[model samples]
Target: METRLLEPMESLISAFVLITFLQTALGAQEFYRQPTHESAVQGSSIVLRCIIKNRDGTVQWTHGGFGLGTERNLPGYDRYTMIGNTNSIDVDGNSIEEYSLKIDNLQLIDDTNYTCQVSPGDSDEGIISNMATVTVLVPPSPPILSGKVTIPVTLEKPTNVTCDALNGKPKAQITWKKDDVRIMENTYELTTTQPDGKRVDTRGIVTITAQPSDAGKKIECGAWNMALKEGEPLWTQATLDVQYAPKLTLTHSNPDRTIREVDEVKFTCSGEANPFQITWRWYRNGELQADVNGYQYTIPRITRDFHGQIIRCEAENSVGTTAVEHSLNILYGPKFKGDPAHVSVDQGERAELVCEAEGNPTAEITWRRQNKYSVLHTGSIYVIPSVREGMFGVYTCTATVLGFHEISRDIYVTENGPPQITSDATQYASIGDRAMIQCLSISSPKPIFVWSRNSQPIDYASSGRFSAPEEGLPFGGKSSLQILDVQEEDFGIYNCTVINTKGSATLMIKLEKSEEVQMAVIIGSAVGGVAVIFIIVIACIIYYKCRHSDNESYAETDSNTEIKKRDKNESPSEMTKSTLMDQWRQDYNYRYSAEFDDVDAKVGNTSGQYVCYDTERYGTMPTNHTNGHLYGEGVDDLGPLNRFENSYSTGYIPSTFRSPSRTDFTSGRVSANELASGRTSVNDFTSGRVSATDFTSGRVSTTDFSGRASADLVEPFRLPTADNTTSKLATNV
Candidate 1:
């Protein structure tokens, strides 16, 4: 098959060589012109040309050894036809014959080499010309891509992505690119024969190691062939979804400001991640705090201990994890770093006191006298140029931090080394228990301690309860007040004064109750308070029910007192007014004073004078008396004779009641108000609704209303109170 396919190509080359040699050996002009190549797209028309000296013999065209006769159209290839019969003049005055092939509706099968053959009678042998190639290009389909639509971060492996171009003539050449840049490594192409066996398909593959930076990038699969236009290739692309883990960066708040105790600080974590649903974790000094699904971490109260601590923030997504760290810088208050300084000097000499302190932002030092808070010097050292008798006192040194706490220490400037109380001597104890009060004094000579209570020395022998114990120590001495069977009187401000040859020192020791005793006292007080409140509430409820009860009690008949009754002519209010007016008139200028003096005459002579001899169920009621006058009344007791029974009517004289004449023997005048009326006001004297003017006008207000009364001959009215305590009114003038 190979030999048969090459026979036409070999014969065409031999004919081309013979024509060239004959022209060169004979030194004669060429008879034929070589055909130039012709190109066209598939399904389009193309023309192939052949030129010679003259039109003297028959001309024909052949493709690959198959001949097309002198007829214009070919046998099976209707698209192939011969053209050109006239001559086209050259630079020389020579005639030329041309035979060109015209193909219409060109297809891929028409792509082959063609040559021309001529026969000029018998004298000139038949000749075949050199071959001219006819190329027909068919464009392949647009590139189709498959594999790895999204790539994840893979450190141990690589991703394989593929692209294909199907059934292209001169099989398409395929390649891969990332975001318009070509990829060279781990890339290859494949070619497969198509079904018709005339064309092939091409496939391109690229293996890559995915990185976090490749997220949201583009991967391009391009196909190029002879059918494609120059500088333009068939391409397809996909935006890469590279699922990568997070790379975390941490930021904090208040970079310029200091973080003191009770200050707040905030930290935030952020990074680029493929899956945005990431989790964050916070750590301090390598200790994990908590796992947070968010990015912010807050320290509500930053302390000084966190100054050198390391803060870490970690972030994680579906793929991996990352972290960042920062060291904290915290600020705090100043403090005295070393032992308290002491300076000793003579009456007229120089001395210095140095104060050493430490703090964040550094501490400032100042010096002042003890008990005198004014700053005397500003520095870490205090120098006294001259010491005098007036300067023989304790000095104080203070270290201060701006906007923070300050500390102070005292420096003694004594003429001789004196005793100074150092430790707190306050103590706590319970009654019936033993107690010990301690006092530590610093001095060269041993200190002698004396415990006293309220400026009086304790009589140990008299009470047999107190004793003074002393101890000698390397620095100074320790003294304690010991009490056996401590009583309540022992808990007080007890003075512990230490005396030495150098100087004297005093300490006030307050003995207080212990926690258990104090708590017991509190509980006892609470229980007692509840009991008292319960008793008071019960008493009030009983009083309310008894005072408001409808049934009234009766009082003993007072035969030595005057009797009064309700008057039919007076309303309840006017009766109240007449009662008060009668007191004002009968006492000094009171007109009713004479009426009570001669009660027998008035009852015998006056018909409508008064009557109240009947004693019934309503004999007692609460009464009210203010400023020597009765005012209040009881509940409804209305009737024809004593409508105000069990009320102020007990003290009133009735105007409608016909007093019995001398024949009607009546008992001595009875003071019904004093004997039967009840009293319940917190104050002894209670006022009523009637004002001073109403009492004077005899038109007083009672029962929440106003009524007129007779001022000349008035009755004494008594008022009742809610508590119903018996109250008395004077019947004698």
Candidate 2:
């Protein structure tokens, strides 16, 4: 079949018409119906309906993607009974065209999309209905949450927590909070299942074990669901408190009472309390030591200064306080003194007694006499009526204070008298001889005598041959004592003691012996005898040996003198025989007598003419009157011959001379004529000569030898005038 092609617009219009025509020819029509979109809660009812445009068609309904017909109905539509047509509708009023649906007890799952369809005749295809989507909308009332209705209900016991909520759209979840934290499930019991088939929200009861910390805490319950706009909450709170009391105790502070200077004693007060503070205080001598909080008190070291002080310790807390006390007692020792206990005083004189004592609190003093009489009290001085022997015993002074007592030294009083002593021998005596010392002390009442040998007292019985004189020997109006035969043992101090009613006195006796006076007589006699014998022997030997030698040298000197005399033309008259003789005598006397005898004799003969004569007769002779005249011209007429005679008479005579007449001047006195003439007399010549017989007999002879010419004599008799008139005359001749 050849068909004509149509234009694009015509073809589109034709296709539309054909489709529409086909729809009309097939007897298919769309049902234009409004689905009754009614919303219900989880446990409410709902209904949906369809409206048909064609009168002769079949109608159907569906939910979500599942078909909905009479055999398989929609959810919650099981009990639906259709009230409209089941096939094509009659135009005028047949019961075959209208379509409708019903649902009861809707749930959350029941809300969905619905569809309605229509078929016009039996042999025609059905038509797709216009999409009149009927959506199930719910009006956000208070939610009946599923878990709240059918879920488990849980609660903790003894906790006042409400399992309820408010102001939620669908439903809100509810829970309990402790310390702002969720409670554990294990702490609560729960119940589930509701009376209706729909699920309900559950509310849990919160159980709490209250503690001190649980006071003033908050508990809560709430509900929520997906349909609710916000969660609903219920809240509650309470306050907690606890009560208690405190306990107390005490302890003492100081254990040792011996406190140092400025030392503190501490007392401690302690206790256990909930809300209280502790305090401390102290008391001393019933008075407060300080204000409160004074746990310690200090006391300086006590002296006599602080003897009766009292101290205490106190302990306290907020509740109350108590006290303990102690006392201080200082101890001191005793002291005593006495000055000049023993003193000396004259008879019938007054004496003093001094006593003192030192003690704590000033000791009380008392004085008593030796005779038990009270003398003084509480002072340092005591006096006696009269110082006598009866008052010579110990006087005691006692001091008592503060239950302590002390006694002073004993005081003794005495009187004074004269010293008594005597001597059996004089003050001077010979050495190695016996002497005596006697001593006696006389006091007013006849004091007792004590004898001392040296410094120590002597026992008369033990000392051999020592004797003491009778006591109370009256002499010179005083008593005396004599000690006999005192030896060197009595040389040292000897003391005499005397006692009387008044007092006592002491005296010392000393003795000494002389040595020089005893030896004077014996020394003088012995010295005189020895000297006389020594001189006699010396003179005898000198005369015997030197007599001849002296004569020969004299003769040789004369001869040599003549030779020298001729050379000088000097005369023999110028030579002096007396000078020669004196020289010879000095040499002989010194050599012989000084060597043999230890005696010295000084010659006082200044004329140098004195001869040492063995016999006293020769010693007085004028041997060289003519030589004296020559050499001693114009000199004094008196010669050594006169001096020799005077010395012999004065006991300077040699031992060889024994007759008493030897002491007399045997030389004849110069006559007045010889004095006037200045010449030797005939008697002087006789006195100058000595006999051989006298020498041989070892005695000085008094025989006259005036006419005898001996070889020993020089011959010339050239006498010079006393005035040197002859020397002038010879020079002139």
Candidate 3:
């Protein structure tokens, strides 16, 4: 408005000022400009920008009023970038007016107020930019729900339920629900931030008191955050548990609990319980029977031992234990009263057997053969009209009752017979040889045997040189008689008699000597006759003597009478008879020669006789030097010769003949009294009063024989008579 003098320098200054005003309005210095709030996920890149209208301004960045970077210096900065220098260009190819403070990885520490300040080169005063907030968005992870998880839980106890949310940028919220209904209770909550300050977590807990009505109900927990997606809340659930004791109810099909032996019996125990795990056990008569895992118990076979006994079943678990009992009434089968041993019956005889038994309920009796199922009879008494040999077997008597096992008894039947002889009735044997006669027979209970010869019994005590039957036989049904050495007397009738209670039988046997025995007797007689003749000749030549006339006959008569009396008493065995027979022969020969000499020679003379001396009696004739003739003296006594002469030769001879002495021949006047005093008797030799050596070599003194006479007379022999001859000479010769 002032029109003053117009100079050229002033006009140039006004046009230049107008151009400066236009440039100032077009480009001005400003710090960074951004939205009031910014959002980014953690671990993502973000920028805090400061925009300027002039590039000549100096820019600096600050976090919460603390310096982060300047135009020329960025002190102790990491993961942070400053961009847009003087030579930088934007997307539109113009100078870039934005100074960016960039963090490469966004974290929780990056989520705060950031400030940008700028001072233009022309002005020294700085201008501070508006504050901007960065938010790190994070979503919660899967939740954890914890509590008691089993069903039918124990009652009246405090059980805690909890829900938790983890790793959320903003703090999470947790809640509880029951059966889809929200729950309001004294819930405790806990919140926590991570050590790096990047995430936040929340946990919530609630306690529930369990009741019977809460059984089988569902409880749930939920976790949520602002950063969560739609319809994606974290959830977990649990159900309530209840507990109780067992209640038992037993069941059986039997209305009265009555059973029979061998019948199948079953029992069951079942009831309601809180926890269904149950174990069952069975007991009988107050004793444990079996353990059953389930609710049922069974017995396949019941016996009389279990009758009137109680059976109990118990069910047990962790909650409680309960039991139930059932009493059994049993009917038993038949049992034997008494058992009989095997029976023996004769063939073709009738048999009757009775089987006695006892039972609770009377049993039905039946009879059958063993291994043959066909029934033979239907009564306790079994009878056979006529028992045959084939009917001898085992017969079973079975007693049976309804609902019980069968009991059986077996009876065996056998047969018996009477004794019968089956051996020959005649036996032949040679004399002086062994012979046997066996009487075999068959009978039941065995038969007793007795052997008899003629009529006398032949037993161990009576038999001589023969063996009778022993008390028992080698073979069961037989007996034997063994004649060890048979004689003429043993050749007679033999009877083997067997007796039993049933009957008696006799087998007659004739024991005959063989023909060879008769021939042997004839031959022995002929040989003995020749021997006797030779003995008589030798005796006649040895003892020819003069005879005493009247005394000889009288002496012989007295000796013969004495021997006859002595022979009546003593009886000798066959061995003793043989010994006496040999002595009889010698005595007979001597006595006969003396008698022949008495017929020929006169008394005290050797003429008209055989002139033989007694050389056999005396060892030799003693020389008679005074008479110029041989005379007999010093005679050894041949003991007991004439006394036993006929006793052995025939049957038994009496003591008929006296022992002749040397004095009887030397002195004819000697009487029988003196001869008897010095003579040996037959009893002395046979009865062992004198030894055989004393008989054979006895000597009589010359003084006794000569009777103190002068040695002038020859002794006269005491002659023997016809009665003194040996009976063997009378018979065999």
Better of 2 and 3 by TM-score: 3
Question: What tens-digit string does per-residue lDDT give for candidate 3 at 1-733?
Answer: 2456557669999999996876565455444354356888778888777666445557778887788767433757777777655564555443456677877678777878887777656643567778888888777777777644643444666656667788887877777887898888868888898886768888887777678788888988777776676566778787766666567877775657467777787778878776778777778888886555577778888787777788787877654567888777778888776754444456678888677665557778898765467898987888988876456555678888776678987665534444455444455677778876666553333578888876878766556677755333211145768888777788877887877666777777666654554777899999998997798567434422211222244445463533332232233344433434445545544543313221111111111111122322222221121221222111222222222333222222222222233333322232222333334443433323343222112222222222212122122212222232222231100
Tens digit of per-residue lDDT, candidate 1, span 1-733: 9999999999999999996675444332235576767777789898877776644467888887788788766667778887777647555545577777888999877888888877763334566678888877777788887744554444434766778888888788887889889898898888898886757888887887776677778888888778778869888887666565677888888877767776898999888876777878888999888654478889888887788799998888765677899988777788786665455444577878789887676889998866465788999988888876456445678889887879987654433345666433445677889877766555544568787888998888897878877766433566767889988877888887778876687777678766554778999999997997698568556644543341143233633211112221234355546554544333322322212321111111011111222111111111111111111112221123334333423334332222222111122222112111233221111112111232233222222111222332222332222121111222111
Which of 1 and 2 is ahead in TM-score?
1
Deviating ranges (above 4 Å) for candidate 1: 1-31, 87-95, 120-122, 147-156, 195-198, 241-733
Could you tell me the C-alpha RMSD of candidate 1 in Å?
A: 38.0
- How many clashes in candidate 1? 24
Ranking by lDDT: 1, 3, 2
Which of the two, 1 or 3, has more lDDT? 1
TM-score of structure candidate 2 = 0.19
Instruction: Give the C-alpha miss distance for residue 386 in model 1, angstroms.
Output: 99
Q: Model 3 — TM-score against the truth? A: 0.28
**Model 2 superposed RMSD (Cα):** 55.7
